[model samples]
Target: MRGLLPQLVMRVLAAGLLTVVVAAGWVLWDTARAARRDAQTTAALVSDAIAARPSFEGLAFGGVAPTPVFRDWQQFPAWSLIAPGICVELGPRDQPIQRRCGPYLAAATPPDWFVWLANRLGLVPEPVAVPVRTRYVSDAYVTAIADPGVIVTRAWARTGDLMRVAVGMAIGGAVLTGLLMIRLLAPFGLLLRGIEHLQRGDFTGRLPRLRVAEFDRLSSAVNDTAAALQEAQAARAELTRRLFSVQENERRALARELHDEFGQCLTATRAMAAAIAQSGESTAQDGARIAEISGQMMDSLRAELARLRPPDLDDLGLRPALERMVANWRARMPSVRFELGLAGPIDAVPDDLALSLYRIAQECVTNAIRHGTPTHIALHIEVGDAITLTAADDGSPRHGGTIDSGYGLLGIRERVDALGGSFVLAPVENGMRAVARLPL
Candidate 1:
């Protein structure tokens, strides 16, 4: 698509051209009208002058006479050389018309094309016939005609200077406007390039200060945005590294626990079975001890599985899983009061949205308890046009500002980002609040 500069320039040129056309047309029209009037007046006066002649009065009573032509009107140029083309025709009513015109004076002839247009448009006046009258029966007729060439020639003479000025002014305005537009839009290219860099994920791109105040502010904003994005990218990179480390450590712990606790428990059960088989009987005390080992193993497996993907989530869906999680946390932190609020159709959320919301809430709660040591923590989940999950705690204030990025907070952000949701972890009311919203 064409930009504003070219469009504005074209409009400006078009307006100037239109103005010139209108002004030139008005000037030509006025001159042509005046020229036609002068031709008509000259014809009338010549007819009057011819009727009073003694030669015509001495003619026969039947008014049968030769044509008398007068051509002196050409000697005196009337309004804009109009009289030059005037002609006087006088003759008996039944005879051929007489042509009596003067030497048609012309300083310059108008172009054939202009004369053709004037004639085609019928702007040139037709020859007018005026009857000669006397005391006796009058048979003389004087006709006046103005040449189309004369009318066009006169019109051009009157309008040429103004048209030239209009053309010059138009050219000057276009040039000045183009130059000014070019200067005004110079910064647009730089801004476009900087924005392209951002689109390409090259946050390192920066724009320079511009002379125009509005463009300068935009340049500064671009520079600031690039800096902010660069910083966020670096933080995310660090977060990835730390998160990977945390995952590896957790996996190692799980492996160690499996080897130490599970191996021992299975080994002891094997030994007990061997002894019981040898003894050919099952003792109550031995059965109780075996049951205790089985309980410990089950507990250990549940804990490891919870660290990965909670079994409750897959089996019971989102709401129940969240309820179980809260129950577990409440059992673990009996002194810390917890509130869980669920609204709207929580079950209608899709798998990805549910997972992300659950993770965000889980992370926020863990962070509040682990870092902030809050006495009261609240978690609320709402599902409508969008799925919203908010977790807040009455803990020590990190201040009512953006949360400092940590491994847990990053994990929460990652999940929400994957689900195309916005996440904010900020301080509120002497506590921390983490909110996430995902579109349904």
Candidate 2:
């Protein structure tokens, strides 16, 4: 859990960067294409402007041109314009016969656009083109071509320069976008820290209110959950303290009951038997009667042990425990009737929960007998992911005041609550019903 946050953050950042890169790359590609098209258009326009001028025809002839046309052309510095170069006029046999005004050619292979335009314009053997640098110029120079071809070749160079600019902007944009994302995501760090503190059993921290509405709601929800958990933990601790106290008292009570009741009775009975055997006056009938009484006393002691220890709870299980409890109740009040709906051999409940269930039933029965004075009682035990024990008595309520609860009900409630269960008592027709639901 401690390492979960860093791992989540890394995953989010990796995904974000990947998405941004893919999207930005696509956008940049489209921008490059659009820039190339615009460059081509500008290049054609500039070439046409130069070629349409009367001064350019004389300039092309080397017909004593003024310095201004050359100066003006040089001053037009733009990505679209193709640089000046030489051309050629063709003779009847389609051979280059004269040089035309243009810049010196420099390219290992003529640009494809240049060759296409020259052929389409019927300017065979006379090539017009944009010069590209090479180790050595091509032997096929001074040929016919047109201005558009030059512009097309220059469009590539201009597009190359625009690509560099686009790349710089894209990088800067990606960095800025990353930073903004980090800022937006920073509050989640606070939320995660709060959760970590809660996980470590520190539920006292107050979450900071967030500017984002959803985050604010989340912070509030977490604080509420923490508060509830803290309260529950405190209640559990208190219950445990009380339970241990009760267990210690019960242990002492059991020890005292054994020593004072069973132990003293056995010792007196042993002395009486010894005297009867030693005395000549003692009759055989008297000895038999004493032996019978001693046997009964031993049986009683064994029964008490069985009641206290409850070995059958582990062996015969919850069904027997509950049956024995009901039998004991019947013995105490023979006239009182009970209808039990025991869901037997219930899917093996946790040992602690089974004990709690048995104890809660005992408490309800005892309460019904002592307070409700009910002639009839109903008991039901249900089992599943949780266990529910319910007991109801149909009898008149005590008229004077609310019945005060003794250790019986308190002990049952403590046990149920210790295991994170709920206990409720409600009026059921003419009597009261006690219900306990414990998580298995």
Candidate 3:
């Protein structure tokens, strides 16, 4: 049980941790993606700002008379270099005359990411021939003047550095959250231990309040379950004691009935037979009367012996006992055809089990003969781990009813149930079926 608890806890904890990890990781990844998107958008705006400048737009090396150099420069004067590490430049491919519009020197080339962005924005034709290295570039933008000039700019570098810092914080937060979950779940182990102790018949331990409301409720439920189980055990023990007491009393009464009633009747019959034999008569009529009286006494004696302890049960076990019972029923009701199929041997059964099974069968047959008023009755018995006795017949039920709680059937049910067995009475396809299955 102790070994089992940790496995259960691990299963629960793993499920909870997986849920948290999936949710938190999704949020972190989405935030990172959104940050990268925002960085790119900012870079594009800065590049466009630098590109729309008059002097930077296809300006020749010496022809600068069309637009003033310093008048409209303030409107878009390399604001792409507004932040640290940002740079922008406009260079002509014809004469290699580069105008430094932004913060960095014109000799510097923009990062590869900026060149790719420039091509995607249609500032240059497909497949720009610039050789550039691959690296993490948060945001950069570039523009080209069809083959005459190319402008490149850096923007949102500060946003890139901020994103890196945010990623670090997100990872640290995830670790800290996982640690907190572990701490919160630690008390669950205590609750589990408390349940284990209760299962091992130790109910003294009380779990300390975890301060978590949910855990507190769980602890209360565990304590209640332990209390309920203890109460049920006590009640069951008391009921068993009462049932045993009743059984003992019944056994004592049966013993007394056999010894007092049957014993006295047999003793008187034996004495009467001896006296009649000693006082023999010579007349043939008197001899015949004496023989008849003796025969009646013997038959009565046999019936008394059978009542005290059924001789058929001892002689042929359950099968012959049921057969004799069926024969007796047939003799009593000449109109009824009683069929008996004692299917299997029942010799190995204990005394109590045999008695319970025989009583159930006798009661069911008696009920059928009394109330069913059937033309035919069938009795079937088989013994295995349990004794199954069934009495089915083509007869109508009593009380103008198809179903009722008759005394005999009720007694059979009570007896079978007392011995941890099953009793069933239902209408079969042809007639009613009475069944008692008692454990051997």
lDDT values of the candidates? 0.72, 0.61, 0.57
Cα error of candidate 1 at position 188, Å: 1.0
> Residue-wise lDDT of candidate 1 within 1-440, one digit each (tens)?
99888888888888898899899878877866765676677667766665555344324556576433334433433453326656555565457355655345574766777667667656667777667665443676666676666667767666677778998898789879989999889999999999999987688878999999999999999999999988887787567545645664576577567757876776677577556646646575676567566667767766765755665766788889899889999999999999999999877777645655776787788888878778999999888888888898989778533345644766676666545567888778879888888878
On lDDT, the stronger of 1 and 3 is: 1
- How much does candidate 1 score in TM-score? 0.48
At residue 360, what lDDT does model 3 achieve? 71
Predict model 3's lDDT versus the native.
0.57
Report the C-alpha lDDT of model 3 over 1-440, residue by residue, as the tens digit: 45444454555556555655555445444533443443344345544454454343324656554432322424553444332222222222233223233333333354677456545543322211121111212122242222202222322232344445665555555566556667878777989898998977665567776799999999988888777876765665457446644764565567567657766765666566556656665554554556567567667756655544566886677667767877777786899898877656666777666766776777777777667668888888888767788888888644322233534766576566566567778776657888788776
Task: Let me know the TM-score candidate 3 reaches against the reference structure.
Answer: 0.39
**Candidate 2 structure lDDT:** 0.61
Stretches off by above 4 angstroms in model 2 are: 1-307, 398-406
What is the Cα-based TM-score of model 2? 0.42
Q: Which ten residues in a row have the lowest lDDT in candidate 1?
A: 67-76
Each prediction's TM-score against the native?
0.48, 0.42, 0.39
